[model samples]
Target: MSAWEQFITYVSQNGFYIWTEFYRHFLMAAYGVLFASIISIPIGILIARYGKLSGFVMTLGSIIQTIPVLGFMAITMVVMGLGTTTVVVTVFFYSLLPIIQNTYVGIIGVDRTIKEAAYASGMTQFQLLLKVELPLAVSVIMAGIRTALVVGIGVVAIGTFVGAGGLGAIIVRGTNATDGTAIILAGAVPTALMAIVADLIMGKIERMLNPVSN
Candidate 1:
């Protein structure tokens, strides 16, 4: 039979297993991005408010981003050991740069005239940030999140190497077996779909957050 036929047969027999792996994969990426956002958005706000820290913080994120994924994972393994924790931590670290950088840029990029008006109205620093800056920067921040989410989805596949249990496990298993192309497809196709779906969803959110007057 053909590879396609084999794939069909495999899925027919192993649908439950594939679904479980896909769920785990989705969770890995979702939790990672979620945690990163919680941490990074506030840091971004701080960086924007204190211009002196912007360069140092951005540089730190860039340095982390430059680390090879495998090398970072290896280092994390030493500290975190193998499993979901390591995978989640790795994904979280990878997701940080874009989110934080975009948030900082978006906030600082707000028109100076608008900022002055807010200041002239006696808005406190917290008030200006919450009412003026964050609202205006929502679209940019969402764009960063969308990018990070898609990237995290792809990265989560690497989790299988450390026994974190995602679709990557399927890919790894397939590579280890004879006539495993079908098995690899079982994992690969779903991962691609996940990324596409996440991108589309995030695109809608980004558009929704953008000011209609703009």
Candidate 2:
């Protein structure tokens, strides 16, 4: 068979497994990231607004990030046991730094004049944050979310090692067998594609939310 024919055959044969597993992992990772985003964004905004102890939170998140993926997986498995729950928790922990930092930066980066104008217009603190700060900072927050998504997609592959059974199953099994490069490629290629698609979608959203021109 030609390369195209082989590719088509592979997709035809394994498409269901690939698509189902991919969607499961994607949703799991997205849930973790969503939780992280919800918790971190407001905290980030507060830190930025108060200008206090941002350094500490960033440092804590950095330490969390420095833990190796395999080590984290092993540790989580021991603590939480082998399941999707452990994996989701792990991904959640991993996603916090980027989201928090981005939220802080985005909100803080809003133009001072715009904030002043809101105050002049007699907007309450809540009104200003909801209407002006969040809108202006949305692009930055989305950028963080995009970064978390890409990173989570990569990291959550470790889930399969503990029997969570997503696309990572192919990758972990492939690595174990030593000659399963095709399986590895099957898992990895879709992840890269997903990341690219996610980036494009988020980029469009970011542009839509951006208050500044160009």
Candidate 3:
């Protein structure tokens, strides 16, 4: 086939995969972030609230990071068996460190003077947290979340190795078929698009939710 005809043929054949799996991969990445956030945010808040726990939290997250992804997945599969649960949980755990670290840093980085002023103004602890501390810390927390999301997107794409299908299925197919460009585009394009869109959306949300200071 001529190059133009080959291009047309590839587009016709593969466009469905792109459209169908793009959001699937996006959701997989999102699932990783959501599950990780559920576990990490509360713990990070507690760690920041108590100096004693900060060391413990950091140590644990760091230790988890040291474990290789393939090893962790194999262990999880052996213990829990195959399928979505194992893949999701593995991706979730992989995503936790960034969220927890970022949250702790963000909360701790709040200006002490602002905190004091809020307290002196008769604002309750809850109010101070809601109106002052969280708003200021949002940027940092979002940065952490952004990092976790990017990492999770990359990792979860490999979950096809465990029977969970996403865009990774396309990648695996291309690899086995020896179609180099197909695998690269199939995997890289959707992932890159997801990361860009997610970061942009989160950036807007952070700006909107965070209070502006003069």
What's the TM-score of each model vs. the native?
0.96, 0.91, 0.87
Candidate No. with top lDDT: 1
Per-residue accuracy of model 1 over 1-214 as CA lDDT, tens digit each:
9999999999999999999999999999999999999999999999998999989998999999999887888899999999998989999999999999999989998999999999999999889998999999999999999999999998889988888989999999899989999999999999999999999999999998987535
Which is better, 2 or 3, measured by TM-score? 2
Which portions of model 1 show Cα errors greater than 4 Å?
none
For residues 1-214, what per-residue lDDT tens digits would candidate 3 score against the true structure? Answer: 5544644566577888766777777777788789889888888878888979988888888898898877787888887687666677787888888999988988888989998999999999889878887778887788788888877777777777877677777777766775456455665667777878877888777667565631
By lDDT, rank the candidates, best first: 1, 2, 3
For candidate 3, list the clashing residue pairs, or say none.
Answer: none
Whole-model Cα lDDT of every candidate shown, in order: 0.93, 0.85, 0.78
TM-score of 3: 0.87
- Angstrom error of the Cα, residue 152, model 3: value is 0.6
**Which model is ahead, 1 or 2, in terms of lDDT?**
1
Instruction: Score candidate 1 by lDDT.
Output: 0.93
